[model samples]
Target: MIELAQDSGIWTATINRPEKANALTDKMLTELAEIAEEAGQPGGARLLILTGAGKVFSAGADLDAMQGGLATSPVWERLSSAIAALPCLSIAALNGTVAGGAMGMALACDFRVAVAGADVFYPVMKRGFLPQPSDPARLAALIGPARSRLILLVGQRLDAATALDWGLYDRIAQPGALMDAVRDLAADVLAATPQHVAAIKRLIP
Candidate 1:
């Protein structure tokens, strides 16, 4: 499923199935909802930092799960929205390649940090389909329309440095230093007043 670890006020959620590139499962998504619920409560958790176990962050939803859903799957959207709406500030620490619906999870975070080896490619179009339909607005906000078009339409793979240059990642760290960097970032966030963080984040229209 997932690994939950805590430091002072920071909670780190690690996607643990490295064998499958930490692919998302319906059970995993449901577990995430429960984790979010726990973290949202009083005296529970504050800032949440998400990363993966071995190499890649996540390779997107489980193909078996997706097939099982058929035409009526709401699991993906539900879990993504839950992750997006958590009161705790969220940070994504990408370790490797990201693709397909997995980008949706990364996009939900308030801040994203990646290592040089990390990259992302969304190939829904090449597969003869479009994105989830609601992703355009968020994608535009993070990386702008032109880049988003390049990614979604052309299916270009963006290296970490290129992504940073294009404003995809707020910062980049060496692969080995990523977690340390993320910890420092979480500490900085935890040091701030929750009201200020909430206010400033909300004011970003």
Candidate 2:
């Protein structure tokens, strides 16, 4: 499930199923894509902040739904692409662990802020599945080809500090302070004109 809120030009989307480690379902992914589409429409929020409700950011796709094969679903691609194409700046507030396809979702954001002890990994290979088509390029764009290889090929599980150092996360906050850090960044972004921010976001790779 997902919850979306808007206040003073900032839009926040929270993944609400903490009991399942916020593992994504088809409906949740669809909602994310829909929210992303709405964010680009007229009079939409100026900034978008994506976060998870509890200690796990997302465990990625739900295994039960993958019985037919993961390739049958296009929601992940749609959601990530929609997020990247938004006119306004977007941030992924990584409150906790991020793994598998969730890494692709986080990489789609313009910036990311993770809690100090959060961990990141991409285990597609280990699971005998290839990475999503958009994932490798996006990951490479954020952390460079070498590091991306280590993550995608070597199956490295990076801690928050290493991820920050590799440019995967723009900032790190202490536990229980992730939202505070996000709000501070949101405030700084709000100081700029929406048009200016949108223009700058478009120029980023």
Candidate 3:
């Protein structure tokens, strides 16, 4: 359900279940938590990029896996918190359509750079679902409550341009260049000292 590729201080995690719009299963979320924990260790990584393979980034919770009523399991809260607590710099390269819990994953990152024309939104309300607490809070902090509601509650599918305009994403690259763009952004971020990065991140917000 995922792939990990590392180079020097940069690590990339890719959601691999493209056949299901990369929908995350309970197992997948568990694996993601593990990855986040592993990557958070000092010297293990300076930057971590979260991405998805194939056409759709991730459609959110895998209905198939939740069919037996695993939807209410505590695993979701654990996974969300793990992603939020990860210590290293995290970036989300939204290369395709992103929705539902998958949107929460993207929001967990410190920076989000998506591909232009990509469909990026959280449609939890449309599915009769609610985002975990961390999701809405983080989204509101990143893009403000008004825009957050527009996306989360209203089920607005935001294209890259709209996302950038609302500050939902830091930048919008051409489709198919998401990773390259992320790599460049990572390089820029890595140019700074870790102490400085952490200090600024903490002091400013």
Q: Number of the top candidate by lDDT? A: 2
Q: How much is 167 displaced in model 1, in angstroms?
A: 1.2
lDDT of 3 at 160: 77
Ranking by TM-score: 2, 3, 1
lDDT (0 to 1) per candidate: 0.77, 0.87, 0.79
lDDT of 2 by residue, 50-94 (tens): 999989999888888655565347888898898888888789999
> Model 1: which ten-residue window has the lowest total lDDT?
70-79
The residue ranges of model 2 lying beyond 4 angstroms of the native Cα positions read none
Per-residue lDDT, model 1, residue 170, is: 77
* Superposed model 1: Cα runs more than 4 Å off: 70-72
61-180 in candidate 3: lDDT tens per residue? 888776755456566677667666665678988878777777777887888888775678777777676677678888899889998888878888888788888888898887567778
Q: Which run of 10 residues does model 3 get worst, by summed lDDT?
A: 66-75
Clashing pairs in 3: none
lDDT of 1 by residue, 106-180 (tens): 777777889888898878777655575556677889889999999999999999889888887878986599987
**Residue pairs that clash (backbone atoms under 3 angstroms), model 1:** none
Of models 2 and 3, which has the larger TM-score? Answer: 2
